[model samples]
Target: MQFLQFFLCITVLLLYCNVSRSAFLCELNQANPFKVALTSTVDIAGKGNFTTIQSAVDSIPSGNTKWIRIQIFAGVYREKVTITYDKTCIFLDGAGSRETFIEWDGHERTNTSATFTSYAENLVVKGIGFKNTYNLGPKQNDLVPALAAEILGDKAAFYNCSFFGVQDTLWDVGGRHYFYQCYIQGGADFIFGKGQSFYEQSVLYYSLETYGQGTYIGYITAQGRDSADDPSGFVFKDCVILGKGKAYLGRAWKAFSRVIIANSKLSDIVVPVGWDAWQFVGHEDQLTYAEEDNSGPGADTSKRVPWQKKLSEGVKGNGHVKFKCPTFLKFKVKAMAVTLSDDEVSDNESDKTGLGFVKSIFVPETHSPNFVPSSKPPVSEIVKQAEVTPPRKIRVDL
Candidate 1:
């Protein structure tokens, strides 16, 4: 018993010394140092690199060029997390959106209250859920801006993630961003910002919790495009909008607010007027809220706002709509498609897409020559309506 206690004490001392020296914890776990150098596991139980996500991030040097993966284990982290602008090329891999959660309940100014704020460019966050619990927390407060996550970086992508809040849920402030298979749950202008973003196969869930009983009114997006050619807008492709309460698709937060819901599913929760001019009331014509190829009970366009720009179904064969593809900074990547399942796609169909095999297509933010324009011309101008091939589901890439 004495020997065992001595050995345990020595082991603890060694771990402390190495950690204080900034040495890799892989020494104790018997893992390869090379792999440990690239991957920093953030386990709150203290079995990995650091006990907190912020510590794991702080370990990385500023202006990092190589990719560093921060493996966040399953846990409920109730802390505010921020990634500064200089800390780039970070890959935040969580256990799963349902398993790993970063939650906080700050009701302060929206600028200082986001649960997760990432200003680092070239960042990829996967399988994580960020929640701002201001309303859900002890206070069950009034309707105000409680941001879950704010992205102010370029080339940031999120996959299989989720955001939870009320009012201003996700502030996509600037730059080019992509959200894939993510869930955004909120009410009011939950998704408001000026970033050029593409939301693919995501779900926008509106919750009328903060509003008084039967007040069920909300606005999903408040895009802030300020000019005729701001090049920044919100595009939802192959997404689903289903939730409680009635809400407008968006309201012009600025002079030329722009938003598009294309090839998506909308529940009856969507208001018939669809969009609101808001502060830009008389200038509704300048608001660029558009919809195309959408299905579901709420997709009727007859009662839609007059300013809603209606798009056309141009591309054939893909279970998708052709977008005005975008160009990202650093990498002039064209929104392209990759293959999903062999049985799902046919060889002839594959050949027609020009890629022997492919799946989804990257949604556009602005313009790329590879994809058809936002709105295609008449049937006679492109192809006869009868000749157009049916659509199929495919995977997309940037």
Candidate 2:
């Protein structure tokens, strides 16, 4: 009887484990389901399939095999959006960064503060702006950080997108991500996290409001690589660092944090001491902060931290870093430039009103010989639709 009871208990335990695992997988599937083919396209703007970006994202089935394309119209969507882990191969396209924006007002310690957060693999977001309205300045009781976008998935790429906030603007958390021709703005520890990421042809802008503040001194990055064996590092290539006030290139968030800025241009906003120890004085020697072939006034390394390294010639080739898996290349494509012409302008007087008059006055012929303007609204019209507001002040405890 004793032996039989023990056997029954073991069986029940195994069954419970299996059931829990299945339930977790089911939850993931519910968040992201498997689909048949890439025959459907979801449009946002009360026109096509969905009205909101999150609704369109939720509509996608789990373990999606083919690409799920979501086209967002020109407008400001005041909401937080998330792409869960199971939703793979998603292509989120927007009208333009200035034309289409996603905004929220969440600060650090807030449950849902990030304007956009992605935990899905093989995701591509282009031509959109993500912003957090939580400003970090003297008006606040304490320094409260806000994240515009938090990317936490592998093989994720953002092109021509803009991220705006005052602190922790772009959280490069846990991913092999690539950002091309994107603009990221923040004040302190703006580009941070444990991700192995590559930023190419992107702009990193710092805000002047947080300059000279106590602990909020402008620092662009705070990479958190725990050890030398970790394959996570941030590589900035052919990028530009610009904005107001003095700032450091980066600070070691972890002992083995690694960062590289190669073939980039830095404005005078950067401080002479390019890197910081970040309370880890002795451990600063273990960090791998390096720069090569960088130009502009801030590229001078004469006063950089003594522990900072100047990358060797052989290591500058980017041959040692394994960014992402081989299949990740399937999501890469040449960025397209959209141009408008006079011939494509509408003859209707009402359609040719407002900013259209300004566009009509300056029509350039250098665009494409085959380029024919369509009746669709011009890019400037979409940009004009965006409403700009002054930053808001919030109270918080230190």
Give the per-residue lDDT of model 1 (tens digit) for 1-398: 00001111111121112122110111111143322237889888889888889888888898666557798999998888999977776778888777888998877898988999998866778788898988753465776788999999866878777888877999999876888767787888999998878887777777766465247678899998776535567888877787767888988888978777877888888889999999877877666677777898889989987767644232423655565333321124354221112112122322222111111123232211111112223212211221232111111111
Mind sharing the TM-score for model 1? 0.73
- Candidate 2 residue spans exceeding 4 A from truth: 1-36, 39-45, 108-111, 136-142, 208-216, 316-398
> What are the models' TM-scores?
0.73, 0.69
Candidate 2, 1-398: lDDT as tens digits: 00001111111121112122111111112223322133234344577677778988888887764556677888888888999988876777787777788988787563356889998866777678888876743555344677889888766777677888777888898856777667777888889998877787667777746545433458999998775445466878777787667789998888777777877778787899899888778876567777777888999988887777654333334533212221122322222111111222111333321111110001122110111112343222222222121222100000
User: Which segments of candidate 1 are over 4 A away from where they belong?
Assistant: 1-37, 137-139, 312-320, 324-332, 336-398
Worst 10 residues of 2 by lDDT: 1-10
TM-score of 2: 0.69
